[model samples]
Target chain A: MTTASAEPLLSLRNVEVVYDNVSLAVSGVSLDVPEGQLIALLGANGAGKSTTLRSISGLLQAARGKVTRGEIRYAGQLVNTLSPQDRVKLGIVQVLEGRHVFEQLTTNENLEAACPVEMSRAEMRSALDRAYTFFPRLAERRNATSGYLSGGEQQMLAIARALMTRPRMLMLDEPSLGLSPMLTTEIFSIIRRINREEGISVLLVEQNAFAALDLVSHGYLIESGRVVMHDTATAMKNNPDIQEFYLGGHGVNFRDIKHYRRRKRWLT
Target chain B: MDWILFLELAANGAVTGLLYAMVAISIVLIFKSSAVPNLAQGALVMVGAYAVLAFSDWLGLPMWLAIPAAMVFMFGLGIGIERHALRRLAGQPIIMILMMTLGLDIFLRGITLAAFGGSARRMDLGISDDPLFVGQILMSRVHLTGAAVALMVFAALVLFFRTRRGIRLRAISNDYVASWSVGIGVEQGVALSWALAAVISTIAGVFWGAVQGVDQSLSLLLLKSLTVAVLGGLDSLPGAIVAGILLGVLESVVSGYLDPLVGGGSRELVVAVTLILTVLIRPHGLFGDRSVERI
Candidate 1:
């Protein structure tokens, strides 16, 4: 992380975090993300990838787990003292894991929920129209309740809702977790477009290594709550260790076998 | 024993039942939104009655002016309770929050007693206190008006929830994490829910005071209303209204006819029996959802 040439848009310096005393979720992890760059965080199951994002979002109190180490700076401000809501107001938004759409609310209502009142009616309408243009499926079901939407439509609605906030940097967790291959590719293209055209920085966390590597320019590989490798996406894609542990040998099909097992275990 | 006497009592019971339903609706609104059955709700009703009496009778203000003013004061009180107390203890156990509200009930009651003094004052609505006779049954003009107001409020609330704001509130109540990630102002929605509940409570207080006379004893009626809500379903507003009316009719019947053999206060006994049976039959209440745990 000590490249030392370009200023990072968001940087985590020597962060240490522990959860429940027995489980050390993250320790001595440092990450540097530049402005308008799409970076992927690749990790196996239980490798502290989710914990890192949670800390960044201020949803999980790092103080509770003894930061014991370093500071997180965003756009030249020390954000460790700010609450989750304050972080949101400061243009940092996280699209949480699982399509966390307000299921009882309509698609349009859900879109309007995250919208700050700062935008004028015309501006809001344009932004809303842009979202509808991006996902016409959501537009078709604009007044429909979220629970009734198909899983893919719900995911689209979730992303659309987050975009309504007009975030400077969007952090997405498992965007393609359970989607079909075609849907996964569609979402990846949108992520790439957001970074390239919209100039919105993306901090994407995904276990779909093949897709993530194709999408992100640079990335860091984490294991057991520590960073084990860091390089360009091309280098990480070629790494044997990542392929064997996370990518299921070929790294082509990321249908999430472990998730299937986990769900099965719960049912049994 | 006459049919005319039975009909008269039934009409009176219907009016009183409607007032109880309005109060029960308030309890359901707060309970559904915050998942905290506000014990202080009864105290809020007593405070509302006292506010109306002080403004209209003591301060010599017109009833029209005092009504909205009393509701505003109660709304402020509700917001204050949420900001100073409930918000801080957001994730605490339900029992712990309920206990805190119970303590709040005592604190509010003590304050009201200290301020208003310990005497029953007949609150004049400045309307005709005369009862209208229909057959052998007589109903007060105030009671009839109270019924109308209660009906209108419930209708309005039903429509409000179907609107955008109401949908947002219900979404938050159903799942807060989903609501928050969608950028909903969940904390604000929760506060607004409490404020709305307080406004309804204030209206209920005014009507109850008109029928029973405003005093410290007004708080006792809250218990009966609470019992009705619990039986009807604490989460269902319509259930609360239906249960309130049903209980009112049942009590009136017992007192009017069966009391001769069972002795007076038999109505209370019947409510107690019904409460026990309801708990056994449907612990979640008649309209409440069965508990569904997420994996």
Candidate 2:
């Protein structure tokens, strides 16, 4: 599944992100998302997964975070200095965590708001149609205020809004967070459809290792801001360490959990 | 109990309220996008009056040409202030931004004083001062024209918000990070907000100048407009309109009936009391959205 010879759509090489010029959040992280391929970045809270996504999208500035080292290349062009809007123009978009949407606006208005300023009325109509085709639930509630949407519905709207940009690479911070198991499966299937049908490369960051590994061909395991393990999803799922700590497999005694952390093969 | 006097005062108050609504709209525009109350709004209004005077009276441009020229000049000024002054202070505390606007108010006032001198000047937009009769209620022609223009501008704004660009601005106001991720330029939106606010303030200043001759005191319109913005809820556009009218009528009725009893000055007192009561009571104003917490 690794298209190593092809130029990746987005490649982050030795990226280091520092916050407020002092605290280091992500250091020496490297990864790639090949064209039209779905990739997963699996990590726990504060593991620098979201930070890496933000650095690529140029949203780090808002959090007073700066990329101090390494280069981020999109479509074979260095995008380290581009503004967030510029990055978006070049077809990179991120849906932030916690389902951020224009709560005051209707679902229709939320989608319309994401269209480029130069988009014509005809183009806008087509774009709306495209979003509706992907998330039919949103079309029914198009005129309802987005703030009142159910948790699952709002997550769908957030993804639909991101699609309004017609992005080449869609990076989701966590599409499955807080969603019920049933809703999570539904959303993941739709994400797979978008990747397969629209040919948009995806970089999904999720803490739900089971669902994320099921969705992507390749996975990167991040720990405290570094890429600890990168392998094909099948290879990672079969690894004994991953099965013990991440895949919900029980083998060791409860008291030895802390000791097991020290024995992680990758850490050793 | 003069019924006719009461009706007359109410009519006049409503007209004055419309003018206040125009100014309040300007303040609301800036606050919506940046979440900073533009304390310099009144100063912007005062300078707008002077800018029009400089173009029409000094540069000898026609009234039709001068109005838009002044708007263009102020538009550039608005963008400049946001880019050079306010943009640099991004991520600072909200208080720092508030203080910066206060500094802008004083700086603009000083510049106006230095350039235009400290004398009252009549801005005759050619609207007659004669009282016009609308079925027994006498209204000043200038007031009627000002109200008509304000209404038209309000209608235009409502329509603007329906456009794609306008919707983008609204989205930016709703959430900056979301807007940024979707490719809406947040900085440009903030700059555009300031430019539009400055343009609206110019229209406000013109009407205010027409009603009462322009002078250093014109800058004090900020106090009345601020009262209206706060009373209307700082972020709500319709709230500004309703609150402006409410404050206007309240002030007029207070001044009309109570001024004689109190010996001549109660309008300012009425405004102060209303503002205090609003802050203490409804704090979110009549139309402002109450912050909601989702469990």
Candidate 3:
């Protein structure tokens, strides 16, 4: 498949994130989310996947992390210095990892809380209506406190709340974490529908390689805070190394595959 | 054992409790938004009362204008404290924030002493202190007016929380990071909490000043307010109100009946004992939400 000719909606050029002014968390990574495209960032644990997402969303500052050496451009404008709230106002919203909904707030209030400060009462109501339509399960439990909702329902609320901002691009961190297989499949399909129907670009970070690669049009494999492989979804799925290590293919013995060889294959 | 005196003391205690509720609600608001217990709350209250005194007595403003003017000044002061002092220390351990508040309490007290001198001044809002008969029992008009005002403020707070803006503030209290992700300004929310707390503290200070005179001892109300907060659970608004009334009535009855028998000044003892009993028996307070563990 050919890449879109227009400039990407969000682009990170050689981004380097440093934590506490000492430790490097994300090093020299570059990626893009073309307009209206679904992209997945696949990585192992502590591979800086969440850090990259946080950097883009301007949430790294809260964690004592900074994008020290790269430009994070959203819609052709530099946004490295923008506050997270400002980023959301500029149409960038992130669904934080672990489905962090306002547990004490009712489901409807959770969405209402996400509406922009300048939004009119009529606009807020319609935005809430749009969110509920996307997640009907949340609508059914609108008045219930979010903490009492099931895991799947909380994830839905998190996404729907993000949607209340009417974001041009939605970045989700591990939407499938700790969810049942059936629920994960159902959520991924809904995400695909949102991308297609709402025309919102998505930058997804996930560990479920099989499901992620199947859903995204393009995928980037990250390791040790750097991108090791970038390819179309079909190409990455067929790569032997990704198949052996990430996709759980062939059930190869751990001792049989040499670590150096695996590293060299991806590096080359 | 005069029934008339007993009824009068109880009625007065209930009104005092309403004032305590206002101050405790301020503490709870700061705690909810920022997880800081605001050791400086009493100082804020004292300063608020002194601000009113400065406006009305020193500047010769009318009581009507002075009260609102003082509230606006205190509101700005609250935001300034949060923005200039506390916001700079974000990402530090909460204990550090608590220590900062402790230090702020001393700093504010010093400033008040240097500026106002250590003298008690009466604040007359023109509300009559004359006792009026409610059936057989007598009630102070000052206390009655204070209670009515406190209840109205409580109603306003309840309605505020139901608005979209208030929901945003509530969302910040729930999770700062989550609130930020959804476009909420966490720092602004915290600052607004401080501003609101300051306004409430000013109102509490005015009532306390009207009754007891505006002295440095006005800051001692913080101790009673803290006890009320602890009894109601530090984060619960309704709990603070109930606890405030309960402590108020308890103090009045104990001091009224037992003071003559044990000399004077048993009211402070009631607060001390109630605080201890609450800690030992119900550490979560009466209305606090208990953390539930899901297996």
Candidate 4:
């Protein structure tokens, strides 16, 4: 993974979030991400990685238990008080974990729904064309209801929908979750391609360190509401600490685990 | 009833039905935006009629100027209601807001009674007051004009909702959070819907006043509008209008023909029956969105 030669695009300093009065999800965490770089947030279940992402996006208000005691700057602006929509307008878009692409809308309509380019309809049409070029599967199933799309295809649609907003940065929560290995590979490969070819900065939060670190330039390991380690993907991958705790170590990849096959597996 | 008389009564019922449909359409617009039934809608119509009458008689505005002026005034009044009463109650219980608007209706009614003395005022609106004889049957020229006005207004509204502004309103109604995230001014959109509904209600009231004469008793018209909206669907604008006319026609036929056996006053009975049937069959209304529960 090669780091981009540019100033940091997003920086979080000692950010803290506490739910209710008791649960401390994230505490005093900080990280800097440069432009056009893919950064992965790795942790186990309930690791506060999602909470950190949510705080940056302004979805989880600091006034709530999801409070931020430190500074969060995006493109050199303090965005702690900005609303989620304002954050989105300012080129920070998050695809929620479950790929909740407006289920009632058609695939193309769902893509069209997030369109923030307040230009004439003609401009919007060209934007759609560019988005379709990236995700041809969505273009093919343009008229189909989004609910009918497979998990993989819906993930692609979510990415495409975020692209329509023309964001400089994208925060995706577990793009590979609940997806088949082949689908996961395709999703990450496209994300890597988007980062390399299109210069779009990506901040991805995933439990699968193997897949997430495969594309990220740097990785932040969160454990119990704190960043246990922050290093380059190469360093983190090779570090014994990450392998011992986060991953089951021994380079034992979950993708290689297989069992006896049955004929015609159920999709669900 | 004979076929000849049946057709005549049906036509008459439909003309009146158009007026009720127009009123229901006003209610539907407000309901979609605010999720409130807007009890003042009937009062709004009466206000428009009174405004017109007052302008022509007291203020000396001509018919052309007076009508538009009344419409504009009602539009302001509608926005004022939203800002003063409804805006504070946002996100509150639906029944609480309903009661609040009901209180508004009563307040408006009291003002009209105080100022206008509850007397029906005759106006020379210059519209055709003579009934046109269609062969043996006679239909009032005013009812015919009311039907045409209702149809034209309905068409215009349908076209407006199909436009960008209309899509914006529907989007706000469907998901307020999503609409806000998409850079839509939700407050402005809701206010615009209320204003538009107020304009429509005012026009309906003016037409009703011209046909039936203006009086404080006209506030009962909102009851009919409520019935129309409930039967059609709370969120469906087209449903409100169509259900209104259908209910009107049914009431007409039932009351004219069956009133003899039922001892008259069957229109109210017909509305009650339609309300029960719609609630049982489609709780969301004929054209309202289906409530999708999250798992």
Q: lDDT of each structure?
A: 0.79, 0.90, 0.91, 0.79
DockQ of each: 0.33, 0.90, 0.88, 0.21
Q: Least lDDT summed over 10 consecutive residues: which range in candidate 2 chain B?
A: B286-295
Q: Compared with the true structure, what per-residue lDDT tens digits does model 1 show for residues A177-268?
A: 89998999998887787777777789989989889999999998777677777899988878765666566774543555575445434532
* Tens-place lDDT digits, model 4, residues A154-228: 999888877777778888888988999899998898888777777889999998898888889999988778887
lDDT of 2 at A134: 90
Q: lDDT tens string, model 2, B197-277?
A: 999889888888988888888889999999998888888888888888899899998899999999988999999999999
Clash pairs detected, candidate 3: none
B48: Cα error in model 4, Å: 4.0
Error of 1 at B8 (Å): 5.8
Question: Which is the leading candidate under TM-score?
Answer: 2
User: Model 4 chain B: which ten-residue window has the lowest total lDDT?
Assistant: B286-295
- Compose the digit string of candidate 2's lDDT tens values, residues A25-51: 999999999999999998889999999
Question: How many residue pairs collide in each prediction?
Answer: 1, 0, 0, 1
Tell me how many residue pairs clash in candidate 3. Answer: 0
Encode model 1's per-residue lDDT on B82-123: one tens digit a residue: 878888877776788988989888888999889988787777
Candidate 3: tens digits of C-alpha lDDT, residues A1-268: 1343378889999999999999998899999999899999998899999999999999998889999999899988899999999999999999999999999999999999998889999998888888888889888999999999999999999999999999999999999999998999999999999999999999999999999999999999988899989999999999988888789877777564687356756694
Q: Model 2 misses residue A9 by how many Å?
A: 1.5
TM-score of chain A of 3: 0.95
Candidate 4: segments with Cα more than 4 A from true spot = A1-7, A16-29, A42-54, A60-68, A97-113, A116-118, A141-158, A174-190, A196-198, A206-211, A221-268, B50-58, B111-117, B122-124, B134-137, B292-295
